[model samples]
Target: MTDVSSPIDTRWFYALVIAGICLNATGLFTPILEPDGALYACIAKTMAQTGDFVNLYAVGRDWLDKPHFPFWVTAVSYLIFGVNTFAYKFPALLFFLGGVIYTYHFVRLSYSWLTAQVASLILLTAFHGVLSNSDVRAEPYLTLLVIGPVYHFYRVFLGARFYHIVLGAFLTGCALMTKGLFVLVPIGAGLVLHWMLTNNWRELLKLRWYVAVVLSFVFTMPEIYCLYKQFDLHPEKVVFDNTNVSGIRFFFWDSQFGRFFNTGPIKGAGDKFFFVHTLLWAFLPWSLPLYIGVGNVVRSIVKRIEVPEYISLGSGLATFLMFSLSGFQLPHYLNIVFPFYAVIAAQFLVRLKPTALRRWTIAQTVIGVLLVVLIVGVLVVVQPARQGIALSLSMLIAVATFVFFRNTTLLSLVGRMVGAMLLLACMLNLFLYPTFMNYEAGLAAARYVNEQPQRAKRITALYGPSTFGESSWSYEFYVDGPTQYVRDDSVLQQLAGQRSVQVFTTNIYADSLQSRGFDVSPVAVFPYFHISQLTGDFLNYKTRTSTLKPYVLVDVRK
Candidate 1:
């Protein structure tokens, strides 16, 4: 590594650290006017508007797609920031910061200060961080929880500082609160793997992992009670087969393991390579390093390094492999692995000299700027959107760009990687995010629904985003009203046998509704989407632009 680990090097290193993180926050945080963020926003707004925080609501009913921690955070943010996009992003920021700070400290314990800085930067700006910031979801918060336990345990595991172990357990509990049991998967896998690989089962006996288990459960009790009180206590008031749904049961059994087994609410075909490829974008600048790190660890195992340093690499690979093998996968699932990568990458990067770091910085900067240009270029050319660019085929370009970081300057790979991420973030917020997010048709359709001349007490979707669950929560978001969810079975059913329904959907769904003799007209229109895996593929009959041309207004109240 470089002499940059000297006193002056520490100063310059921290300077880069602060600069990298802040630049990332500023550049990547330009919120897109996408409905997904707004979907969360609207739910939080409903909580604030109606003074009901006990349960989540969408289109004026219980929304079960996600648990409530993210909602609580957003609701509190709405209360403080008064309902803005940044408010939705605020908690995620705190969680991500937790990941960065913990990684910084954790890496410092294992490697030189310079490497620690690079690793922290990787955690903040790399794959998961970039896209995660844009979408503002529950994953970022969960990432912090996932890392906290492992980081603390690493300290305890290596140094016998038992205090960190308790703290880690508490953070693991918080991760449970943030999203459920996922907080434990990484920590548990890492610990078991570390023990087996290092032949240190004797060390494991003394750490009192049971104390952690107890404390994490103790900390998680309130969340469990709240979930039970809402879902189990009041079953009839629930929807989506609410009578059979048990929130507590989900916490203990279904939400975690069932999903892995394809028995949960979200089921999909698994690709063993899903995570391998998703990591290309989800774990950015560090993606390549992790590639090297994983390979190195396997090689070390083959060579039988028999060292603790090699064990760290093994622990990382353990978590990575477990997540990959699980039946369920999402791009952001690999986020927690960054801390492991950070430690390894820091070891690799800080070993370089100052001049090498400088060249690394320039290379990273060049790659990042090029990424921004590509993303911006796509928004300009294909699927132009406004408010913030909505998710697009264009964004697939940005995803591809992050993968290219693997090829940039290897000398100070961390610097170049961080540099590219920082640049990409700047370009997105300053130049692109604001332009592309508006293509999401849900918000526009919601707005139009809210502005009906003679406001109705209820709204419906005959064929799209039934009620406000998916496409049009913005209607309730903008309107002084609540929406009702209803799906039409026979669009042209006889009026004498039909119930008059006030429906909102893409213009295409309206045609079938028109045949059923409802008073249908164009209420509003916005962009639409068709994803085969996203549940939207059922609406494959229409193009987003075509369906979005006119959101159908139907008076199905027979």
Candidate 2:
């Protein structure tokens, strides 16, 4: 194996690490975005409050879409920190950070200290990796579960230690519980392929390998037990609008393979090239070199060149291929395998011949510059309210990038790349999201109701039959009082004996109530938009107001 041991400045590497961490941490306190983030938070909040870990509930109904592990962890966070935005996001961020540490150790064990540092920086700075921390989804949890186990399993391959196999099996069970049977594809593919390529038939036949299979299933019993109790035992429970549903069947088959074939209760249109295009941007500054590195690995393998290990290549390519062929695909789905990609990219850079190394540096430098320019252009277009703060931070990041770039080493390149993207993410977390929150009517309405002097007043949020449970989950989560959802005039009937109540609804619904001879007095109005899904018009400050719809809180005399 080729090794480039000449060290880049240590200060430069540590600075980039700190900046990447800060960028990820910036979103910890921000309000959760609507639809998914809020929905997940609400489910976890329900779990924590009810102390029922067996069944998952959302919008007052039994939810079956995801496995219970991520919610379980989030529920624990809510128990410790209280049910709030920070509590919701804290655990996910910690899991991703754990993935970062695992990445460093895995590469260091497989290669060298210098190579490991580069791999750590690459994984930490990956665009989607950082974004996942803010989004706070199952992906963050998978980030740690997938890589950490692979590290231990690789150790097992080195010597087939009993404890190592046990550790690997444990994490594999957790990964299964977290996502589904599909996660094993990456973990198994990496190790299986490495054994095949190295012609290690003896390792494949080891007794411990069979023991691992049994222990993995043993560790997964919790998820299985929960699913069996919740769905398999109660066939009368309606899930996905169908009766006699089995959660065990869904967990093993429908949730993973059903989605792969687009035959599940939920489906998405697939594109063979979706991830091919996604990684081009999702991997950001590292994407170009990663592609080149992957191609080189394939070429070297074909030519019978001696390489240290095939774990990273086998794991990454197999998972990438599977995702590309699957009928369901999402950009974030690729995040589970990014650690392998980082290791591969780092190894390629470390082993580069000097002439090619200089070329790689130039390409990375140009990518960094373009990244900064693009971010600056976004800030210009958005013209966020926190313009002064965003401008000052951008300038400071610029100064830091220039200082790091002066060194002309691989570590310096890592610093420059991280610094550039750090500015972009910092602007997003600090400026754009804060401004977007201003337009999140649900959060605003919740705050308004919480501040009312009449704290004991009943809170009812109106939703039409079409929008029934689609009502803002964040509003339900953040409000101080339990929120009742009423579909129509039934709200009036439900509040018959009550003297006064506050209703949250869109302007159209508010108008309908007044037209029906009900005395409705508007308490507060908020501009409403889907904060997670941004459009060009909504990002433009001048055009933003025009794009917003109105949501209102009103007092209705009962």
lDDT, each prediction: 0.62, 0.84
Please write out the lDDT profile of model 2 over residues 463-490, one tens digit for every residue. Answer: 4434743236878888878776666676
Q: Model 2: runs farther than 4 Å from truth?
A: 7-12, 455-457, 468-471, 488-492, 509-521, 556-558
lDDT of 1 by residue, 1-558 (tens): 232453224654575577566655663345434456657778788888677877777755566666677787778877898765677777777778877787777666655565666667667777567667667767778767776787787777777677887898888877787666765666677677777787877865763788878888898887777778877787676556547577788777677777678787666666778877887766665555567656655676788864345434655666667666767777766666667776775565555456765665565556555666665554445433341433433355345435644443432355445555655565556554443335445555555555665653444543553444445654545544455444545542343145555666666677765666555655455555421122222222233344334455555543
Show the colliding residue pairs in model 2: none
Worst 10 residues of 1 by lDDT: 530-539
lDDT computed for candidate 2: 0.84
TM-score of each: 0.79, 0.95
Q: Kindly report which residue stretches of model 1 are placed more than 4 angstroms away from their true locations once superposed.
A: 1-11, 26-38, 63-65, 158-163, 196-199, 234-242, 306-315, 352-373, 376-380, 383-416, 446-469, 478-480, 488-503, 530-558
State the lDDT at 92 in candidate 2. 92
lDDT of 1: 0.62
